[model samples]
Target: MTAAFTVRVQDEIAEKLDRIAALSDRSRANLAAQAIEDYVAREEWQLAEIQAGIDEADRGEFASANELASVVAKYVKAARQA
Candidate 1:
């Protein structure tokens, strides 16, 4: 079961939400919850990656400049091909 919570938005943001809700035929609360869920997931992923990087640094795990260039070039080539 989920519980209700209160959130406050400025007038302009509220108006935008209202318009989106009308166009999508969804409730304001539903759109807000979806937005919040996405924001939380993205932030959590970023935080985990940052922590992993810090842990790697603590163990002195790093790539050389040439190694980095090779990986970047591989992806760039693939992106251009796509």
Candidate 2:
């Protein structure tokens, strides 16, 4: 069972949502629901990845924060060059 609620969106965002609904042949409510579901799923996946990293750390498969910072700095320098 689902409950209905009203929300106020910015004019431009509402217009964009309406266009998306039309293009997808879905009601605006359905499109919004699907988008929210996808967002929740992605968030859960990210949380799982973080948990896995913590588990790896517990197993001694990790680097120190200073080491990680150095690795990140290397990537940042390379990215800036590119």
1-82 per-residue lDDT for model 1 (tens digits): 8878999989999999999999999999999999999999999999999999999999999999999999999999999999
Q: Whose TM-score is greatest here?
A: 1
Q: Measure candidate 2: CA RMSD.
A: 4.0
lDDT of each: 0.97, 0.93
Q: Residue 57 of candidate 1: its Cα lDDT? A: 95
**Cα distance off (Å), candidate 1, residue 3:** 2.8
| CA RMSD of each candidate after superposition | 3.0, 4.0
Scored by Cα lDDT, where does model 1 land?
A: 0.97
lDDT of 2 by residue, 1-82 (tens): 9877787889999999999999989999998888878999999999999999999989999788999999999999999999
